[model samples]
Target: MIILLIWVAVLIAVLVLYLRQIYSRFSRYGVKHFKPVPLLGNMTRILLRINHFADDIFSLYRSFPEEKFVGRFEFLNEIVLLRDIELVKRVCVKDFEYFLDHRSVFSTSDSFFSRNLFSLKGQEWKDMRSTLSPAFTSSKMRLMVPFMVEVGDQMMSSLQKKIKESKSGYIDIDCKDLTTRYANDVIASCAFGLKVDSHNDVDNEFYAMGKLSSTFNFRQVLIFFIISNAPKVAQFLKLDFLSETSKKFFRKLVLETMENRELKNIIRPDMIHLLMEAKKGKLTHEDIKPNDGAAGFATVEESAVGQKEINRVWTEDDLIAQAVLFFIAGFETVSSAMSFLLYELALSPDVQEKLAQEIKETDVKNGGKFDFNSIQNMPYLDMVVSELLRLWPPGIGLDRICTKDYNLGRPNDKAEKDFIIRKGTGVMIPAIAFHRDPEFYPNPDKFDPERFSEENKHNIPMFAYMPFGIGPRNCIGSRFALCEMKVMAYQILLRLQVSPCEKTTIPAKLDRETFNIRLQGGHWLRFRARD
Candidate 1:
């Protein structure tokens, strides 16, 4: 008992000394400090379950609307949550080179997917980004449009069958589940060039895994909390994000596909095929089929670093990691965006009517078919999507770390406070707080699509509207994801009438425990054919 007491005393003293250091550091920068507790820092209330972290962040931002930035501690680490729109602009856009990488806890080697775009940084990120850029270009998306349309057709057919088979004349739909399957079809066709028919097979291995990744339980959340909070120590211990099952499944899948493609000359216009072309120097060559995977390059450019052969192919691990990440990131964003989009439609019938009119007119102009240009050209459709993203961003927070000591200048207009960012300090750009700021957005609680219209969009500050992020490191698949979502929405709206169900939450709230911005409960809505 005496030993336990002594150990507790030592821990308290250590915590106090650490906090005093942080406090002194903030004082030096002339940044305002939040009243913090001993061990858990400013997040004690959140960690103790007294309040949700998102709400706490919102409150903090609201409390000091005049300040350009606020200083707070997350345990021993100092975090600067920037509030001023211009300051955000500096971090994400104008001066992005200084804060390029999102702080990821996992090491690439610990799993097959270590070198994914999300985890890569610096020169490595630049090279990979350049290589993958052409894959998602307008022409590339045009090539893949037929596949996306086919998936949407399959989804509509599947939903019709489910509705027909329903005993109550109304099918109860788990919006997340339906959207996940749709996303599975999208990713499968576009990423792997394989069609698993997730619409018919809810239990399909890929679909199940995708759904599991989106929905987390208590244990998974706890493990994530630990890893994120102590990433360096976790990395030193060789901890990984990919579960053993996911690692085995994806690694085997990518390797077998590569081998089969090489043997059979099976070329496709998907991401895997593009990466394979990069490996063999055949990106510019036309008429290369999947079976032509063995096609060798005309010339191999030397690696910029000169450490590797220019024609050196990606290893099996590299292919698998990239493939898995493509599926994981691509699927979640598409599915979540659909969920929220539908959630909005259910709540606002006037908005739905306007969107339906837009869809109908565009289809009529396109020879009664929802062609590429028709769907892509609808201006209101684009604004509605943008507004959905602005109100409920697919991600709640965007994170970065100070790679070098930098200056966060005070608000140029208001001149409230200034601060120096130290290296290794983690920065959490609370996207929700920024999106909901009434000062930047008038009557922010209301769902307003006109906010994204051509003239109105300019009224908003530059960095204030980044759903797909900004800078060179922004989401590479943004166009693809948007295409898939728009296609799905067009097909569904054309065939069926959607209305909010009792199970749907009128004002959607988030599950704080989950890592991403997900609904507190699953999005549920009723669908009827528009006959």
Candidate 2:
């Protein structure tokens, strides 16, 4: 018994020494960080639910304002939170080759969702990204406008019916639910080539499936945290990020859709059709070339497998993966933005009024028909949406993995010597922190659209207002997302005025349980039909 006790004591001592050695890496690199506790590290608060993930990261980011980068242990892995905009630009764009891959939680072979653009790593990501780029071009976005308009009309009709059913002229509506339905309908039409009435049929299979697939419930959150912090352990355990039910549903849906389209030879100008074209080896280099300003013209290095070999065949699994990505990414992000924008407008009566006036004027200029061109022409609407996104970006933070060893040394900075970031290090860009910083956005809490106005926008530094992120890995469907938001907002604001209701949360309290920046109790507002 005495021998056993001595062995146990020695083991404990070894563990203490090991932890101390691991924790010393941050200090050796001159990186400021929270003192780590065993096992949990700086994530104890978040794991305990004492503070939200976003709140904790935001607090950490704000803590070391003068530091170029702040280090923190995510579980046992030391993650560097980049505070300098210049360094962010370098990591995202200039020195992007060294950080070509996102920190994937699941491997492609493990889950269908993991094969999507967001999770795909290395050359596979680049090839797929290039292949799918043209599907979200300006021309393609314009083609999708009619589909969006149809859904917007449905949404407005549903809102009108709600107003009629209410005893008072104003009807309290859950903006999140309403926008989600609109987003569901739009994504259904554009992605699946099916006109789903999500507004009327609340429990429609497509919408329900979408919600199930995207929801970050308690179990999912825990799994995501584990996978994100300890990817190797997750892989060792053979964990899958996507639920089996979601995978089966989406896989079956894609297969059926593809088979039907091929059988009928029905050509729909949508994402699925474009994906089908790629499958048939009809997609050319011109179709996939980077046209957007956000995607730089820098030539991406050739993969181990040549371009010709990579483009030879696009399989069924690949098609399903891309389709699932569109559904999951499109539905939640667009709906969230729409809900928050409407909620903000409801809170700010003056901004709402001004925006409504602009829409009305633009409608008159276009002979009361608000087409794609007219929607794009509205400067105020653009500014308002930009500001909304700046305040509530879909992603709280962006992460990249160091594929190669990098020396982070600013030129002519003798005081701060070169710091080595070893391969496999996780680099985090705290986008939410940057967006809310008073240094970049004066009076950051105030909802001011003028901040993005053509005259005032230049005053804001580059890389400061990255709602869709920067570089080649930025949100691919940004154009489609913007078009969807503008169409819904325009249609709603044109006919109905969004106002604060009794149920509306005044300060817009965030749902701490959610991974995304979601509002508590939904975004409630009253919609009054314009005479």
Candidate 3:
């Protein structure tokens, strides 16, 4: 018994020393950071539900106002939180090749989840990117407008029915539920080549499957936390990000869709069809023009990396992976943005009024037929969206893993020498921190759409606003997401005026538990027919 106690004591002592050494790497390099605890590091408070990913990390960022970069420890990992715009510029664009991959988020054992474009590393990423780039081009988006409109019409039909059945002409809408359903149906139509009236058919298999797959529930939160921090352990244990049911449903759906489409020789203009064309090597660089008629100022610009075609034979798994990736990205992120957009509109009636007027005038100008071009050209609508994203970006932050040893330079002019980020070191860009900083955006908390005005937009510094993400590896589906949200917002605003309901929180407050953007008491609002 005494020998066993000594062994246990030695083990604890070794653990303490090891942890102390690992946590002291920042101080050894003279980098600025708060003292991290043994195991959880700076994330101890976050893990204990005291704070969240954005507010907590942004707080650390705010702690060092004069520093260009700060240290952040995610569990046991050291992530350099980038604060300087020039540093952001280099990391995202100028010297992007050095940091070509995002930090791994899932176990490799999960084929579909791990092999998606977001998870692909190095050359595989480039090939898949160029391969899929044509599917999101402006011309392609033009073809997709009708599909989006069809979904919007379905959503309006469902909402109108609800209002019709109600004693009051207006109905209290769960903004999150409404937007998620609309986004679900839109992605279902555009990406998966299926028609789903999610608002009307609330218990749909596709919608249910998607929600289960993408939602960050309490258990899922723990699973993903482990996966993100200890990927090898996750892979060894086969702790994939997706639930088993989700894997089966999506895999079968994608493969069967491709099979049926190929066998029947049915050609459609949706993403599946485009991906099928890519499989046949029919897609090429010419699909992109100098100006791709991007949906809004908030859209991610197509770069030369995604422009170059890399010849490779696509596989069945590869195809399924891309389809699933696009589905999850389109479903979750777009829904989050749409929900937030509606919340903001409900809060600011003047913005909604102006947006509705623009929609009405544009509809009249187009002779009651507003297409992709007309909607994209709406300056006020774009400005509102830009501001909305700046205030509540769907993605709280961005992460990149350094592939090669690179000099990160000084934390600030105050520091003596350069700080080198070694290979495999993780770097984080606090997108919300930059977006909400008073220096870049005056009165950052205020909902001011005029900041994105044509005259004033250029005055804003580059790399300050990254709603989708930053650089060539930014959110690939920004075009589709923007178009999806805009089309639905136009449909809703043209018919309904949203306002605060009894359940609505006056000022938005974040839910402390989840990493995703969600309101504290739910996103509830009243939607009535326009006067």
Candidate 4:
């Protein structure tokens, strides 16, 4: 008993000393920051499930009003959160090579998750980016629009069926689920070259595989933290972040699909077909598809780097990894974005009315049929989608790993010297927090689309709004994603009027325990037929 007690005391003392050594880093460097707890670091509230992640970040970001950047720790790992617009611009764009890759979240040996374009590092990443960029060009997006519109029509039909079956005149929906199903079909048709009706075939294997892959439970979360904090340790132990079931399922699907296509010489306007063309060096950037009006605020332009040719042979697993990443991103992320946008439309009736008016006008102007050009050209639709991204970005906070030692100038005027950030350190950009700052957007909490309006959009500070990220390594799929989002909003509003229901929270507060951005009670909204 005495020996056991002694060992416990010694272990606690050692832990205390270790924490002090790490926590003192920011102070020693003269950087401003909040005091972090021992194990949870600055994320105690979030890790402990006491406070919502968004609100916690809101408090931390606002707490340091005068700071250019603040130091933070995610359990012993150092993070510098940039607050200044110029610093953000430098890290994300000007000095892009210095911070070239996203920090590792899983062991690199995990081919499915780690081999995807998002996980590839250095020159490998650059090559893969160049290869994949042609598939996401404006012309490619134009080709995929018909597939998206087809999915939108299916979703509308599904909703109409539900309304007819409802005892009440209106059908109350968990917009999250509705959007998830819609997004599932869109990704299926566009990315995998598979046609699916998720609403009709509720228990489809593809949908099941997507949910299994994307939804992270507590064990997965813990595994992610372990892998993120100590990659070498996780790799040494062969800790797999993704389940073997999901890995095998996605691999077989991709391989079999490729085999069938190759055997039959199938021609389809989808990502799989594009990727096969990419493998043969036939996928090159085409002339930008022209639209009569603005391409919307959330759209990302194709850079010269994206257009440059590259030569690298891809393994079959590499092909599978990209498809699976596409599935996860399209299914989980775009679905959440759709849910949030629907939530906003329900809460703000006037905003909904204006957007509904635009949808109605555009539909009528085009002789009661919508096309890629007609939908993409709506300025008001663009503004609303932009605002939705601002209020609830797909990735609330993201980090970039420094590849070389770089100076971050100074934390503020009072600092004696520029802070030299070492190689391998992560520089976090709290984009959602910056978007919510009152200094940048007055009455920041209000769901106002006018902030992105043609007359007022130039007023937005640079790097303050990056829902699809920024820089050369920014989302290649941003244009594709925006197309998906806009199409759904257009389809739903044309058929139904969204309004808050009994299950909907009045001033929606983000759920504390969720990894994803979700509402407290639920994202519940009533969809009544438009008169």
Q: Residues 442-498, candidate 4, lDDT per residue (tens digit)?
A: 999899999998799999886888898888877878888888999899999998999
The local distance difference test score of model 1 is 0.72
TM-score for candidate 3:
0.97
- What TM value does model 1 have? 0.88
Model 4's alpha-carbon lDDT is 0.85
Off by over 4 Å in 2: 285-310, 410-416
Expressed as tens digits, the lDDT of each residue in 1-531 for candidate 2 is 999999999999999999988888878766788999897789788766677777888889988877888888987787888888999999988999988888867743858867788888887887787677667666677788889998888888887988888898888888888888899899999999998999789899999998988877656777786888777777777777677888898888888888899999999998889899878767654433333432111112222222332354767887888999899888888899899999999888899889999998898888877666875678888888888988888878889999999987632233256678889999989888899999999999889998978789888877876777777677778778888888988998999988888888888777767676778887898899976
Best by TM-score: 3
Ranking by TM-score: 3, 4, 2, 1
TM-score of 4: 0.95
Alpha-carbon lDDT, every model: 0.72, 0.81, 0.86, 0.85
Name the best candidate (by lDDT): 3
lDDT of 3 at 443: 97
Worst 10 residues of 3 by lDDT: 285-294
How many angstroms is residue 253 displaced in model 3 relative to the true structure, after the best TM-score fit? 1.1
1 or 3: which has the higher lDDT? 3
Q: Between prediction 3 and prediction 4, which has the larger lDDT? A: 3
Q: What does candidate 3's lDDT look like per residue over 46-65, in tens digits? A: 77877767779778989989
lDDT head-to-head 1 vs 2, winner: 2
TM-scores for all candidates: the values are 0.88, 0.94, 0.97, 0.95
Q: For model 3, what is the error of residue 321's alpha carbon versus the real structure, in angstroms, after optimal superposition?
A: 0.8
The weakest ten consecutive residues by lDDT in model 4 span: 286-295
